[model samples]
Target: MTLLNVENLRVTFRTEAGPVEAVRGVSFNLGRERLGIVGESGSGKTITGRSVLRLIRPPGKILADRMEFDGIDLTRADEKTMRGLRGRRIAMIMQDPKYSLNPVMKVGAQLTEGLRQRDGMSAADARKKAIEALEAVQIRAPERVMEAYPHELSGGMGQRVMIAMMLIPGPDLLIADEPTSALDVTVQAEVLAILDGLVRDRGMGLIFISHDLRLVARFCDRVLVMYKGKIVEELAARDLMAAKHPYTQGLLNCLPRIGGSQGPLPSLDRDAAWAL
Candidate 1:
């Protein structure tokens, strides 16, 4: 089944200079599969993800020909319906754990709170589920970690906690934006493994957004290459090496390979049409 579908999606921000389009006519479909959106910082990758949950704030407008999730039109859904969908049906894990989590709250409380929001279970039930969720993310001594505040935990631990909180509700779709950017290479791999396992085991759809073409090629089933607020190419991950788009090829060539001599990196020569 197609879990989510976006078509002709456009997003713009109101500014003093003029209206700036962040996402321009982007569209894609997601099933119970791992899909990666790869692009540089201002490619509008993150904005598209945020628009999925209708998280775009004031002064930012989102217009789409069709933005449907499981046959429900997200652009037309009321606030009440969106409230029930967010965090429960379609959860998002933001870029940085530090800003995503509440600094004053204990990890356990935050995790349990997410569970409560979805199921309205008893406090004890929520706590038990919290522990189980933490354990599922491979956190040892889940009980001890639960009692610690976000600041007390390391960057990796905090990210795992964020994952646990988002997964506790068993969301059907997970949108992760630059999820492992702050972690060490080893930790990033571990985290990615955990996310991959969850998607495989639970049959949940995943949108893994990042700038790392190599990682996306290795992890996602399909890849969407975005540039200047537009999707320039979409191809199967296995065939990424054969990508015909100049932007995609440029990104792949930019990755430093092991034992490769360090010299001037090849820059992407952008055409005027690519900016649109």
Candidate 2:
């Protein structure tokens, strides 16, 4: 049941200085499971996700020995094929809804647009599903919120709406790039729960990209620790503490513990040899 497979995936950007390799020879396979990618900024976490969707802009190039989705070779997929896959078979929920949602559009129109247009559902049916989608994400007053514009909803509500919009299409895979990075701890948990429930119920795959080690460890089935644009470690989420890679261990060590002795936080000690 391998939904997506990638091997020796390399992404380079044409910078003024020269070509910069953002992702170097990274590879992984995803099934109907939750896979978490964790790393600091510029560690290639976001770039890797974007590469899957072919979202990299000009001056950026994606190259892979093998990149397949559902038995189709993505490395050779043309724009037309990619368009059918992106947001249909594979959807991405961005880090923030404020930047993702349309500011001027009513939430109802935004949510039901896909269903009405793609699924051939009547306007009434689409509206019904849209409200159900909102309810699925635990929005209590979905009807009231439907009429409200994206700018009017709270941060958490806006995020839930984004999730509902993406899921309404029934995508096989969801790439959530720091979906709750902007929310509070409580809201983060709530959002993750909703995503987890939908993924499980619909038997869909998820690639969760985030910087929160603890959250990934708790929520994901497997964890991939990226450092310097490569996967330095891959381990079961429950066994994250037993990660053997130096980079992963160093990341775990940097977390500040509550009720523990307080002192100057330990700085990460990098080993040049680890990158090779």
Model 1, TM vs. native: 0.97
**What lDDT would candidate 1 get against the real structure?**
0.93
Q: Compared with the true structure, what per-residue lDDT tens digits does model 1 show for residues 149-234? A: 99999999999999988998789999999999888999999899999998999999999999999889999999999999999999
Candidates' C-alpha lDDT: 0.93, 0.92
Worst 10 residues of 1 by lDDT: 111-120
Task: State which candidate has the highest lDDT.
Answer: 1
- Model 1 / residue 88 / CA error / Å: 0.9
User: Over 4 Å off in model 2, which ranges?
Assistant: none
lDDT of 2 by residue, 18-101 (tens): 998999999999999999999999999999999999899978999999999998898888999999998899999998889899
lDDT value, residue 150 of candidate 1: 94
